[model samples]
Target: MPELEVSYKTTSKQFLGRVTTSKESADFIRGLFNEGEIELQEQFIVLYLNQANKIIGYYKHSKGSINATVADIRIVLGTALKCLATSIVVSHNHPSGNLHPSAADKVLTENLKQSAALMNIKLLDHVIITKDGQTSFADEGLLGIKTYDQHTAFVQKVTEALEQKTKHNKLSLEKLAQTFGITDKTEVKELTELAIIKTARILAHSAGNVKERFDKIVELYHAQVNLSHRTSQSILLQQYSTPAPIGYLAGIFCEVDKLKEKGGYAFEPSAGNGLLTIAGEPERFYVNELDNFRNQNLKTQGFANVWNRDATQAFFDVQGNFNAVITNPPFGTAEKKVMYDTYSIKPLEHVMALRALDCMAQDGKAAIIIGGHTNWDDKGRIQAGKNRIFFNYLYSRYHVCDVININGAKLYSRQGTSFDVRLILINGRKLKPEGAASLFNPLKDVEVKTFDELFNRVMDAMDAVTNNTFMKPTNTLEREAIELQKLFTTTELISRFDNPPPQEGLGEALNPPYQPACESSVVLNTQVPDSMAFETRTAIQSIKEAVGGDIDNFVRHRLKYPNK
Candidate 1:
């Protein structure tokens, strides 16, 4: 048997002109297409570029009827690999001449971008060319793909600056205590706050954008204040903060971006240092942390509202008010009693989940991270007994979307311990009365063992839930009663305890991090070239010559238009 030889062939050995702007790339691509065929059909093309953005070659991928064409990502990427191209730009023509991209276009571009990222190849742009003009995904900010190199460089710079600031602050605090013999805890706290404020200002000066600045500062503050110095109470409470990446994934599972765009309210019942709250990024953020220091930390992070109360009884005042909720509640048995309808005592995770569901507004969404043992047994089977009852109650009352078991070993390696953890994504719609009888678990049948698997599973779940609409159940009265009773117990618990007011002035310097800044100046010019019309005319002339100078008949015989 003979093996087939693989090789890339090109008519032109030298490269085309370098492409810096979207307009230049679009013009170059337009020339590659036959002007008559472009209006008559839909076609996908890929331009392979070197590190200097010089086009090595172009491949005509697929051609279809007037309405649509397939952009096979595998073929496109394989050709780039064969050419050793560092980046690629994909283009497709829309015969309809509509400048606005369709939803399908966005999905295809996202899929291609994600796949290209895995091979260390950059997707520079997805250009939509029309007879009249073109649209650039990168120029319109529709790509939604971050430049990893720039992001990593910025983060490294901030991390180094933070380390120096931490060391300097420690030295200054030590000198103050030694020289003045001022050891009162309150005074020492005030001094430490001032040091943090100065450090924040210094970091803020070097940030490239407002979003990056806020995210880094919140992350820095969480790392500096929460994990660097742990209190005895935090340990006793079993406070294991959710990693930032995990928190961000939970937010995606809940569709927090869409909720935030609608100016929705978000609540975190047990917001340790407010990492999950930061991930939620809703227009209005509310947080409750039982630990005094952490509760104060939330206030200092400038949340819209801060409460120092037990997770099970935290948000009684604002029941059914939150539009989004992302929480990582305590995992172990509760030292304090957590009572809900019919269940006097439950696992801390169970009660906390109920508390969050109780506070969600109608049609709201949530992502809750809980212990795997709460639902899965030692052998990974669905646990029976009390866990079944809890899940049954949830299924009867709410829309349980999915249960994804995240690999705990990789998720918590930074903490030097590993355990099973699962995330539950749910919506706030009440189920019909018949739903009570359907006591089935929504957990994934197979275990998720790697971080990539968990991420892909979460993204798939997010897309599925977002695209399909879950009907709002009509049994409002019964659902309302159940929620009211859940809150009523919390209200009773709250009445017996009085929480001190959160400290102020700790967030004064933190204001700059959250303030809006100027837009990034890296946008490529997308204006169509002035010579496009003339070039189109020239291309048409050439096409007419090839088709025996009968342009009208050529178009009439070949062109097909879609029904609007």
Candidate 2:
């Protein structure tokens, strides 16, 4: 019997119609043969399809010859049973250049066809693929009419696999940490295989190359770990100081570093881990450090004369001025940081406010990273509206930029450092609100070659998001609560004609006089993407995956509307 030349032929029914639709099926088939054996004949394929005839699985089984014609049904269908294949397509390759089907190949197909039918399993297609192309005995009228539909629909196998993997972006650190008994998000001092595997699976689903995704996951993890330790802890825990939010701090520092490189003086008051004190920061800026150990660390790192004085008094006695002073000032009051009374052990607000003022020269610029918790008061209004008060205090002489939400962390979480941070740039010389607008530019392009710049940019974006005024949840959030009586204005419909549905249902229920509530509902993805949308579908997907489903819908939804 002459070796049957392999042919391109697949039917809708075989592989549950999945193989027929696959564009990369040819490559996948090639890979299957190459999996173990040295050549093509060593492997055969069994494509599994669902009830709907869509391929749910594409399986590779058994080794035969290296050259032409190397597979059998017994090797293929038997493996399909293990995966619970509803229907299967069995295919073999002929390494020989010619694709003529042999009498033996005919006899073998017949036997498998009869047996599969008897076993209540459908024999959808018998495809023969060769070096040049494929052939279907069924199409040539060599196969009986019954198997015609089965042989014509095989899709591209590799395409299906790639698409399935990339369809949903996912992450693995959470799964591995749970599996390894590493409960704390911060305690992960080292990474394990499971974590790496999880990362691979996740990155396999992103917009960029696989390498970029893995790098990002690692960077995001390192960042979150650094942020997780930054706050209130049990006394014993507090004994060891908390680390700064690594990702956010580094980014803020980089900007100051850039300014310094250009010959501007930069100063840091609370430099932890010196996340921002890079080689590029200004040459003559002063850093007032209260911690003796950290100060020494800086000094050793060439930060000359790291002052071991309180920042409050240090600033009061400062002799020279800085071109820029950027810092992540401590926010909460409970911790016994180097504190001084402005009028009385100063408010955390007053501390940051004063730090900004003191740090600036007449024409100097300052950027500060402040915790949003400090943005409002106990009443849930912007703490004392101090965001404004601080702005006004600084604005008297300097122009204020919009608060930049760095990486989107409202508060550092024990779960991870992959949150947001906001940086507000205030120019020293008094000017209009728009004067510092350029500092708050949203990155239009992403070039993430090294993990550093990419990591910093992502954090910077998060910062912009967190500090966005739209964060307050409503246009008139401060307008006053919607009184029950205000549902219908007094002059118009008093006894009430139909008002809108509940705001909760506003998302699903809104009919278009208004479009679908894409703007109002922050968590839901836009059903139809628009050109103007700030958040890309991939980015939104990334956000959902990063925060887990734990973050509130507001955070999720607002993320989609980056403009807000």
Candidate 3:
């Protein structure tokens, strides 16, 4: 048998050495993609680099339709091993010319990074190339990709170390953390180990010794830590409080203007830092806040009627009712009940809605921001099915007008947070209307951008979706309910209650009309989440224990034997 020798080759004569900058690396990748026919179809390629980042070669991993391309993990890593490269850069072109990485693209980059790390190969960056420009994963700090630092001192140290020859020892995590003020021990330790291991492998592939690689590794950790710090700085100043975006406030006010009576006092129950307070009519605005810092901040800012109290307490303490009430109240079960109990409804925003009605003057108007799922059933039905009861209750009580839905992320997202589900903005008059509640809407003429644009877009979306009633049911709840009903009806104990027995050997039969033991219909109609139901049942159990009898059994027995 003849033996076949495996050999590696460099396909390109262009010796692009030392991938210094993201722009430079991006340009090289762009050039590689440009070599082929630039068409609408997406093509994925991986650039294999040596310790110095000189062009070792590249492999075209996958080519697919205009909208999709596949970069198999096995092939990507296999190509790197074949080339014997120390580092790699994965890239793909978008015919759509959109540079923003889709969620799928981000996931792919993450997978590639983890898979490559196991093989001791550093994935430097994942670049998305378009005709206009490139979006570098390293630049955006996506998937923990390190953005290289070109500090003169660090560069000099690396250059000097490379000129010498010595085995280098890795730096300790504690030393790196202390030097950089990194409190995230876990992240720092992970990066420290990864950088050290990758640097050693890279040095083995080039003229650079372990000592030179160690210097580069230290520099890498510093850049990564600095990037994390910078990202932290971009967070909203009051993220802990979930400060509403300015655009949302603007949109609310634009719609509020239609209902606000001139010279009427405006009140914000859960005011934080007086954002909504300042947004309202200056002379007529009043605020109440429980947060000490925010309350002090409002007072320091010279707000005239800033009450340092719980909103529900303020509702009782204040002398006169407000003409216009608006707020995005906090949402927590404990604090919500503490502010004002809404029986089993634990969401603070819902209690706020009820409180607003109580505190507002006759014929007064109110606008409130609430959680989106308030009117959603377990089946994912919106404004109908089980949730219909909740809306019906609202319609019957207040002159419910409009319900605007917006992404809750916008409120706290200046800090780079994003929520998948939308929140709700409810507007209404305290007085009952003559006919059906006419849901109000925001106008579509305005342009929303940046932090401010989110609110207007929310308003626009709410307005647009008003006529698109009936959210498709996920059917999860329907299936759950049917199963539950079957379980309840067929259970041995429940079956005993269904067919009541003769009363204690007295020969008299006892029978009563069947009444559900726990008001299951009411619970479902209101769309109570499972947690709330559990808490309520626990409370009921406690009461039953205190009374020294099983309440559920009594109710069941009573329902069947009322005529005993």
**Candidate 1 local lDDT, 24-56, one digit each (tens):** 778888898885887888899999887546788
lDDT of each: 0.62, 0.44, 0.50
Highest-scoring model, TM-score: 1
Would you estimate the TM-scores of all the predictions?
0.44, 0.34, 0.33
Candidates arranged by lDDT, highest first: 1, 3, 2
| Residue-by-residue lDDT tens digits, candidate 2, 445-537 | 222333355445445544654575323343221112221123224334233222444444433222212223233454442333221122243
Off by over 4 Å in 2: 1-255, 258-261, 279-285, 317-320, 334-346, 373-388, 405-411, 414-422, 431-564
lDDT of 2: 0.44
Looking at model 3, residue 272 earns an lDDT score of 62
| Count of backbone clashes, every candidate in sequence | 0, 66, 4
- Per-residue CA lDDT of candidate 3, range 1-564, in tens? 999876667656775565655666668767766444445689998888764456677787888889899889998888788877767888898888889999999999988889899998888788888866888887677857334422211332333343343223234334434443344543343333223223322332345532343344334322222112212322322122223233124324333333335556767677665544433333356777775544533442333376766555436744347766766665433333432222233344566656655676655556665544334333222355322434444544554434544454433332123322223333334243222222211142122223335444545544543643211232323323333334444434244233433224322121112232353234232334331332344465566676554565566676885532
